[model samples]
Target: MKQGIQAFISYTYTKNDVWLITMKDMMQWVKNPIENSHLTKGYWICQFNDKIKCSEQTSNSTTKKVTFAAIINVDQIWIWQTAFLVVLYIVIYRYDKYMQEKKKK
Candidate 1:
């Protein structure tokens, strides 16, 4: 038997955990990022502060901080092709700064 490329992938994320499950096998958790998957479509989890960890960010009743976030939603998602991302972020950064300066006038 042989395996084939996955057509669709769905993901769910919490503070400490990221789950990438395929349509084929709903039970299995695919950890590796695959090319041409839905992840490329949009929204990803970007976990900053390697030390603090998303788990630690989880909030309780009293203090509520961001627990898990989608790249476009809460945080940014990690993608395989990062070179382009760097450029994209830089452009966004510069654009934001530009907008702020324009408003300051």
Candidate 2:
């Protein structure tokens, strides 16, 4: 609740394209859109293989839906959390104000 612990993940995905991507250093937890400094933590479980040399659909991308599990980790980076919260509140406050003004118009 007072820290952020984002995981490190990377992978390549392609639908009908012929190029491979190497996603690297993907931070797990992300700040809420309305908040800048407030850090959050989340987990995602899916199929990944570093040895996917061949460019094949990792999981039937053409299908209507895919099955994957999500798990949130309880680990928190205390220092970051505090910083995130401070910034988040400021942003949220401003965003709320903006929304109220838009409604009045």
Q: Which candidate achieves the best TM-score against the true structure?
A: 2
| Highest lDDT scorer | 1
Per-residue lDDT for 1-105 in model 1, tens only?
322222222333434444443433321212222332222222223444311122222233332232222222123223312422453354335445555665699
Candidate 1 local lDDT, residue 79: 39
lDDT score, candidate 1 = 0.32
* RMSD of every prediction: 13.8, 12.6
User: What overall lDDT goes with each candidate model?
Assistant: 0.32, 0.31
In candidate 2, which residue ranges exceed 4 Å CA deviation? 1-76
lDDT of 2 at 66: 18
The Cα error of candidate 1 at residue 92, in Å, is 0.2
Task: Return the clash pairs for model 2, or none.
Answer: 3-77, 4-77, 37-84, 38-84
TM-score of each: 0.25, 0.29
Residue pairs with colliding backbones in model 1 are 44-71, 44-77, 46-76, 71-75, 71-76
